[model samples]
Target: MCVADGGVKTDRLSPAMVDKLTFLRGVGKQFWDLTDARIVNRNITMLRLGTLLLLCGSVFANELTINKIEDAAKAGQFTNIKIGNIQVPAGQTLHLKGLKAGTKIDFVGKVTFGFKQWEGPLIKIEGKGITVTGSPGHVIDCDGKRWWDGKGGNGGTTKPKFFAARLTDSSISNLNVKNLPVHGFSINSCQKLAITGVNIDVSSGDYANGAHNTDGFDVGSSSDIQIKNCNVKNQDDCLAINSGKNILFQGNTCSGGHGISIGSVGARKDNVVQGVIIKDNVVMKSTNGIRVKTVLNAVGSVSDVTFENIKLVDISKVGITVQGNYLNGGPKGEPTGGVPIRDLTIKNVYGNVLPKGTNILVWVKNASNWKFAFRTLWEVKDKIWRRTIKQDSDAQWRGPGQCFADHPQPRATRFTFP
Candidate 1:
């Protein structure tokens, strides 16, 4: 019965398994004190104490129920196999790689993950203070219409990218991911991670639009990340901060997709996306509203960003896209003054767009100390605003009929466009 740091070595429990682990540790201390008790059923008492710790076995070990897929890939690392569920066996990959530190995974009903063509993630949650959860209409389903067929991940068929969480000080919440044959959640190198109320529904890939590149949370090189109250309807970027440092996207709700991004940030020389905080959030029929792509020559440096109280809708093209000649997916050629955006702050952002969208599009080659206080009340409809960097009519009313048109100029050695 040696259960200390080295954990699990069970043998002694048979007094009715020690009275069911003393009534399951008093119902796990009222389910860990209902995690701060807002109490609207607290996820139905955490799914009835995770189905009574999966039918009485997990006081802290032996509850595993991985129905194959190589016994859930050899039960990850097994630090006392506390409480795993994972019901694999439709098409195949349910990896769950190294998990150990304080493990607690769930999902018993609708956990299908078996489609294949290759290059998949299918489901791979690495460890470190892990705690993955699900069961409120439980769904991990990645049938993705048997792999969309619309050139996602480049050219069709090999669709498998479902969920690849590289958690650190983890906490994934009430998840309900769907139709993800392509990108969905690839949060990497997480530290103090807390993704809440997760719900990435690929709106049926918008029907004939065929869900190509379905990204919902592509954070990378994470730090104290906290993606809150999430709910994304994907097609592309709903939250893509490709490098991190104190990131926090709050009260989320993005639709259609290609909103809330912080870079195709410098392709990687230790890519640095600094203290970001996209607050309040809610972007609807998005195409681009709150973006910051930087990739041309690629190096690094996206600093202190803050987009506050944002709420855009129907933005069909550009509501706020800062560019550095991003490639492949738009912004064709010439504008690489090497990733240097600093101290940007856009506030009180309200929204609208669709009469040929384009509320603000700053083509950055380099920026510094920018502050836009979009004083609410906006209903953009081609209120065209473009910046190559030469703003001084007090930054031209800040937006909504904010005029500026001499684009493509910021490179006379950085700062001389007009």
Candidate 2:
């Protein structure tokens, strides 16, 4: 209840949002409140101070359409939440939890659920300074093909888990998710979270009952997390920081998954993945472009990670995959650093893979500064760097450039730059 001018302030709300603000339909007293109130412009967007608020009163009742949501997880009894055209109910959960710390949820139409098979998140949104958004031709359609049975979440039909962001100091913007039956945004236990322009479209699960383990952004134990400029087309791991710390996966754009990762990171309980920053992204036709799996023989530790200026297209399997031996379900030969990958950083990760792909595949074991993160210091001469490091002529390579290939394992190193 915030009118602020000559009236309204209900002690920080919650008498059921002060009886829903006494049905505030006062068309134009022009006292719309959410802090620093002042507006006539209809194209609203105050992203931080009161976030995506559209508490209509004039401009043709700006917007307030909530169409039956059985008390959408009782969004702290409202401060503004417009959703419209909802469906939700098949092992339900559109639960937008305890808001009111500055709540302002918006979505502006078309959201659906209702496909059974339980264990879903379907959509869970915890709170503490919240502001989830989407308006602008919104569409959070997780009709994931009625449980795309190509086995996601590791099984035959128990698919569920579409969004469960338990936030803190939150902010989620421009969400436009579509078709993802397994995982899409599970940013766990967040703190200062900031996700922008999200667009996780499982490109229709990419054909024939596909889109396995969906996974496009699955951050765990989140700390000051910031996932920026998103756009993911998934299959699995298009941004997966299994444990976090000052995390920031920036300027994103991933395609056909398994691209930006960090931790297959042992069993849980905050498996130690400190300060990560995967910057200036773009990993197209993916399958691995700067991955960092750390598991087998589990135990924790992955420090100060950084993979800057990414960008890799056509990557079909490996274009910088730093593994510490995942396990049982892939990569388990003999890596027992039991985690220890400190001060890691792989810079200027340029493109091209898929000639059986494999250009930098360090099979970890105590990786510190992992080869100075590939010594990126190019001046560019030396015959154009020996024709770009001999264009991968089956890299039985060395370093300082005559790089890539022939490490077959045991501290594996397969390079490729430019």
TM-score of each: 0.34, 0.33
Q: Could you tell me which 10 consecutive residues in candidate 2 have the lowest summed lDDT? A: 379-388
User: lDDT per model, in order?
Assistant: 0.71, 0.72
- Candidate 1, clashing residue pairs? 91-114, 92-114
| Model 1 C-alpha lDDT per residue in residues 278-298, reported as the tens digit of each score | 999899888877888888878
Q: What is the C-alpha RMSD of each candidate to the true structure, in Å?
A: 17.4, 17.2
* Candidate 2 segments whose C-alpha is farther than 4 A from its true place: 1-63, 66-81, 87-105, 108-110, 113-139, 146-171, 174-209, 212-233, 236-256, 261-286, 289-316, 319-371, 374-418
Model 1 lDDT at residue 174: 79
**Which residue window of length 10 is worst by lDDT in model 1?**
409-418
**lDDT, candidate 2, 30-70, per-residue tens:** 33344355654544433321321244232213224566668
Error of 1 at 346 (Å): 3.7
